[model samples]
Every structure is written in structure tokens, then in C-alpha cells.
Target: MSARLEVADIFRRHGEAYRQAHHGHLGRVERRVMSAIELCRTAALGGHIEECRACGAVRVAYNSCRNRHCPKCQTAVARDWLAARASELLPVPYFHVVFTLPAEIAAVAFQNKAVVYTILFRTAAETLRTIAADPRHLGAEIGLIAVLHSWGQTLTYHPHLHCIVPGGGPSPDGSRWISCRPGFFLAVRVLSRLFRRLFLEALRVAFEAGGLQFFGSIADLAGPAAFARLLAAARRRDWVVYAKPPFGGPEQVLAYLGRYTHRVAIANSRLVSLADGKVTFRWRDYRHGRKTKLMTLKADEFIRRFLLHTLPDGFHRIRHYGFLANGRRVARLASCRQLLAVRAPETAFRAEPVTDLPSLTHPCPCCGSPMITLAVWHHGQAPPPRSAWNDSS
Candidate 1:
């Protein structure tokens, strides 16, 4: 049987060529991403040996790269993250809202990622809060969790925020929980207009403070007149703010969060093949009835598109705002539960105990018994010989 293909496979096979072709253009983050994905779960990074306590069956487990952008590394990370979030789910209905930038602004964002992405998160959250707080609307403070996704189905650079918000929040007077109208959240038009104005204003401020940078095709924007024109053109367009129907309940919201929170540019399962100097992958064409289609690109182009979504060092892609903001979350949640007369869900996550041989999360394949680590090795070191264990790579 043929081994499964992964993003790591593509990087290991064609990465050096891609690096050579685009050496002048690649950034530090992109280079590191390529290297991490290529070396992930490989002997170069080292591994440990485990034995079933009952049957003595042996297994070899590798260390993960744990790079946020590596597709192979996010599944376990997302699972752990969602487990921590399970207890935070409220009993109220939740809404999924998205705020997307206009193409002109997205072009500017591609060059100034750290500044523009931060602006995107802040303005989007502010718009939601401002609109929901209006007496004419819900008139209550709402809490939301926003996640940033920078790639489209075809791996194009499409920057947007996916926000999950509860149906309501504590009233301004703190007397009661104010629920939104049944089957309705804030108006999309209001949200879009507010988001656009706030974002453009923020961009103008950043430019004035010399916080944004431009290069290559957009180098002309370094001039004040050209930059002003770019903002003016963006202002003339209607920004997109989409609000999907409210989720059935908190359970559905958790499932949805699990899928979106730690997604990379593309999952390994999407790759159909890589052959003859081209890479083929599956993508959903949402504009065309949500049909699944095959897209093939030159190997270099495929690598380029994959690296386009690499985030800057220490940049956060997930954030909480309003009542869910980090510092006040525990207190606000306690107050919210009291208002709603519901108990918080029991937390499902517990910190694993530390020891010389850490416990493995998985059980032995042959005997279904607990597996205990027998030996460990660091990078550049080889594990002890175990004839029973097969190397999958």
C-alpha cells in the first residue's frame, strides 16, 4: 500500500527548489515554517520508545514539531485547546459572524501583516460591541471569540475574522441577561459600515505614526498621496460582514470552534497527488454551488501559496473580547451564570503529571493496555534498536 501524502511530504520533496527560486522574496517566518514541517515527526527531531505493560508490545513515538502552521501538528493541539474551552460554554444560543476586508485593503495587509491584522481584530470586535450596545439594537454588552484565517479554499490570500458570540449579555445596568431577538443578531449592514469606518480610520492613524511598511509593487504607497488614494479607494467600497444563523446551542458552537480555531492553510487529506513537477489538491469552490474541485499548480507555486499564510512571530490568531476578555473572564462568567441560573460545565481537562517517563496519551495497539515509556532520545540521537517496531516514514 502507498503511504499517505502530507504537507510535510511536499516540503521535503520540493522545498529546497522552492527556496532557491524565491530566496529573494521568502521571509524568515516562511523559511522556518518550511523547515519545521519538513522535519516534523522525523528521526531528525528524535523519538521515544514505549512498551505495553500487559503484553510487552513495543512502539516508537516521535516528537511533534508543534509549529502552529504545520498541518500535522494542529490536531492534538486543537483537541487540547477545545477541552479547556468546554467549561466556558454558555447555555445561550451562539452566532457566527465574519468580517472580511476589501481586496484593496487586503493588498495593503499582505505587506503590513502585523499592523493590519491587529487592526482587523480590534476593529471587528469594536464594531460588534458598538452595534450591539446601541439602544436601537440589542442594547447589551456581548462577548465574542474571534479567530483569524488568511487563506481561501484555493490558498489565495483572503484575510478575515471568524467570530463566535453568545446570543446575549448582561444588561448595561447589570440587572439581567438581555437576549437578542429570536433567530436574529445585529444587522449586517450596520456591522459592515462600522467595521469599515473604524478599520480605515485605524489604518490612517497607523500610517501617520509610521507603523506600516510597503515594498515591491506597493512601494508607491510609501508616499503620503499614494497611501491616501489607496485608503480613499478602499473607503468607497462596501466591506463584507456576514452573520450566519444562530447555532442550535452551545454544543454545536463547541464543535464549530474545534474545526476553525487551529486550521492551517490546507490539511494533508486535501492533497490528491504530487507528480510530474505539479501538485494537485482538492478545494471547495464555494462560489459555484460548493462543488469540490481539483486544482493543480506548479510545485514552486504550490509552495509559495502555502507559505503565504505564515504569521509573524508571537502574533496571536485567536482572541477574546468584551465579557470573555482574558482578565475578567472568570468573574464575568460567574456573574453570567448567576443571571441565567445555570451551572458551569465540568472542566474536562487536567494537567498531566510530570515524571521521568511521561505517560502516553495513546494505548498499545496490540493489547489495548497502558503503554509506558521505556527510553528517550534527543535530536541527532537514535533510539535503541527494537526489531518489533516498524518505522512508518
Candidate 2:
């Protein structure tokens, strides 16, 4: 009932019960995620001590688990990632596009995350490259940054990829930049068709290669005939590929990336309450004019929903492709800037170094003076008690 509520609070209180209830079905990644979130920023992980120079006020700070799924650990990580991406922006217009899998395919993806998700990323990227490369469309090689998200507003499993792309790219001959029409980026209908066909074909190949696994309710899909039927049904419907209008400029693109790049299923700020075996949070209803709404679920159900989004270990959720692919990014970017006759942004993109000591940049609450690190401690070691410090001073 405190003013400060977190997913950690819910996990610490009810996670064990959920784990025991689902022991037969719980996964290693999900179990680790729950443990990491529950122990994050607690004495169990240990941390450091800081003191105010002006007033001699001291405080203890705990270490973060730094797990990607922890809501408490993503802010600084996202900031650093955005900083690295700052210099990569171009002066031209940028567009936002989304590729979504249908519910039937999404169900299979939920069962086999790594293979299906990888296929989704590759097929989505290929769809754009294939369509944009055609002489009829933009006639230029393009680049994009794609981020994968597995949850919808209410924490439902809805796998999709959000892509940020420049308005155009260097010509196939490496001669010059080719921009699209003033407001348009690409044809969604064309993109949707290709994405559907490519994804189904890739899924078929993966199934044939024994790269996919089906279980429980969907176990029947293990058969070639059943799997063929699933794909055939998916083919009958149009896949969703949406492209928003071009951004006002590069600045808007950076802002959008900040919100999405390191996001978790739900943020701590959205939490409303945890009481009486229920957890409440805020969500938006996109189907009904984006209306704001609140959802409350049993504490156990909340934990289950949160764990549905644990990514496979070592999986990279964010990726670059085409001219922005990791290997070609630098040279291609320099060439694009030269062709456009534009200089890189005035601000330099430098990554701050990691440090264990508390930063002196934060002002002390007691004296309004800088706080300096007084001591450092590692896991399993506790700093001196407050009483001991006060007595010594």
C-alpha cells in the first residue's frame, strides 16, 4: 500500500507461490527473471556508501541486478544506447514501420521463441529490403533499426517488430541518395504481401529442418499435415504491416527510439496498487480510440503475464540491417553524409564509462552539496551501520 510500488514488490510477495503452482511448466529463464527482479537493489546484492561533504550526511545505496527484464535497470542502459545512436542519424526524413504476426502464428512463436522470433526478424527485414530495392519503388538500398516487442498493452503475447528507417538510401550503383515521395515511405500493401509469403516459407523451412518445437495444446502441429494446415490458414489472411508518415526530422526519431529501445513489458510508473491478492496497473485501449484504462489481475496472474516476455538468453532484441548492418554501418554512413553534403551533428556521441562508485554529480538532499563515495562493498558484504557512522562523527 506504499506510494512507491514496483513489480519487484509483487514478485517478492507472490513469486514463490506462482513458481510452486507452475513448477511443471516454469522455464529456467522465467525463474531467473523472477529471482533477479526480486533481489534487485536489495542488500542481497550489496552496494556502496556515499556522504555529503557540506553536512557530513551519509546514505547507503544498493546495487541493481542489471538484468534486462528488470524495470529498475533499464533507464541508464537506454540512455547510453540512445547516446551511441545519436551520431548515426541523418538529416533526411525518417519513417516508423511496424510488422505484426497474427494470433495463430503468435501462439507458435510463444512456444518456440528463438527460432520463430529469429525468422520474424529476418523475414521482416528482408521484406523491406526486397520491396525497396525494386526499381519501381524507391530503387535504392535502404537501412533500418528494428526492435522486437512481445507484449501488447495488457501484457498479452503479441509479437511484433518496430522499425525505424530513413526516407531513402544510396542508389544500387553507390552513386547518390534516392529519396521517396514527400510524405510517403513505402507501400504497406506491398510490404504486407511480401512479409506474409516470406515468413510462411521460412516457417516451413524451419519446421522441415526440425528447428521448431510444438507442445501441449499445439502439439498436434508436429505433424507435417497439421503444420501445413496452419500455414495455409495463415496465408488466407492478410498480415499487418503499418507505416506511419515520415517524422518531422531526425530529432523525433531519437526521441521515439528512447521510449522503445530498452522497454520492459510494463514500467514501475504504471503500477497503481498491490493489495488483497490483486495487482493493478494502467494500460491503453488502442482498439477504442486509445482510451486510458486500468487492469487488475490476481497477483499470481500478474506474475505469469510479466514472465511471458522473458527473452531467450543471449538473444539480441535490437538489430540493424541493410546499409546500417553492423559491418557496413560506418563506411555507409560516411558515404551517405558525403553524398548529401551534410556534416555530422555538432554534438559528439561518447559513451560514459562504467563505474562502481556513486557519482558526485548528484546533490545531497540534506545540504544541497555534492555527494561523494565514502566506501565501496561487493556482494555479501554490508557497509557499517548508520549508528556506528553517527557515533564516530
lDDT of each: 0.90, 0.91
Residues 265-287 of candidate 1 have per-residue lDDT tens digits of 99999999999989999999999
- Model 2: C-alpha RMSD to truth? 2.3
lDDT of 2 by residue, 74-93 (tens): 98999889887998999999
Question: What's the lDDT for residue 271 in model 1?
Answer: 97
Residue 4 CA displacement from its true place in model 2, Å: 1.7
For candidate 1, what is the TM-score? Answer: 0.94
Q: What's model 2's lDDT at 181? A: 90
Q: Where does candidate 2 stray beyond 4 Å?
A: 348-362, 385-393
- Return the clash pairs for model 1, or none: none
